[model samples]
Target: MFSYRVEGTWRRLKRHGWSRQQPTRRAIERDEDVVDVWKKETWSRVRAPRWSVGPGSSSRTRPGSR
Candidate 1:
């Protein structure tokens, strides 16, 4: 019979190429209300592409294809 502690299990997982992701921390002065307003009012317009080349036209999808 064998058992693993939390630390031992974590070590084994790390050795097997497993990784742990930590949640990012926000600044103390961060304001969610302002962020929400900006996202709704500004982000949409800012994120839009100025010009589009059209659909299914990425160069990486089919190189040298006419």
Candidate 2:
């Protein structure tokens, strides 16, 4: 067996037309259209401004103050 450095072996393989094979990428059990609609509407509701509570509200911390 001839001793060859990894870089030299890789370069030789590439020169001989060898290339890396990547696995096919895909999301399993995913619905792209439903995800898009949820992103557009439901996501907006998540970031929607919340109401601020104050003295004008019905909840009373001190009954004397009310």
Candidate 3:
């Protein structure tokens, strides 16, 4: 059977756009807290657009239609 393990810091870094590379177990385990904080900051910068309707709107048009 295959086994997998995750570190708190590594998981956080991943959410912040960090790439995965093979590292010694000790390094990742030691840095979990710092990584988590960075990930949260990075994620918050990502935003989604809001939509508004105007008088010219047509019923046949879809959300993404131009």
Candidate 4:
């Protein structure tokens, strides 16, 4: 494999249509208190990892599957 400089690598990625995602901006009036509460309560319930394989599924699924 060939080594690349930081700028060169980023340029190559961009050339291949892999633009970096822009940072998400929050509203100036966003409430930190509400955000914190949601993180503690709502996020905890749904933040569990989803990558676990079930009994019949492997890392590779059926090759011809859509």
- All candidates' TM-scores? 0.39, 0.36, 0.26, 0.37
lDDT-better candidate, 2 vs 4: 4
Tens-place lDDT digits, model 2, residues 3-47: 999999999999999988886876787899999999999999898
* TM accuracy, model 4: 0.37
- Backbone steric clashes in candidate 1, count: 0
* lDDT to native, each model: 0.86, 0.83, 0.68, 0.84
Whole-model lDDT for model 2 versus the true structure?
Answer: 0.83
In model 3, where do residues sit more than 4 Å from their true spots?
A: 1-30, 46-66
Those runs of model 1 whose alpha carbons end farther than 4 Å from true positions after fitting are 1-13, 16-18, 49-66
**Higher-lDDT candidate among 1 and 2?**
1
Candidate RMSDs in Å, in order, are 9.4, 13.8, 14.2, 10.3
Among all candidates shown, the one with the greatest lDDT? 1
Candidate 1: the clashing residue pairs are: none
Query: For model 2, what is the alpha-carbon lDDT of residue 38?
Result: 99
Worst 10 residues of 2 by lDDT: 57-66
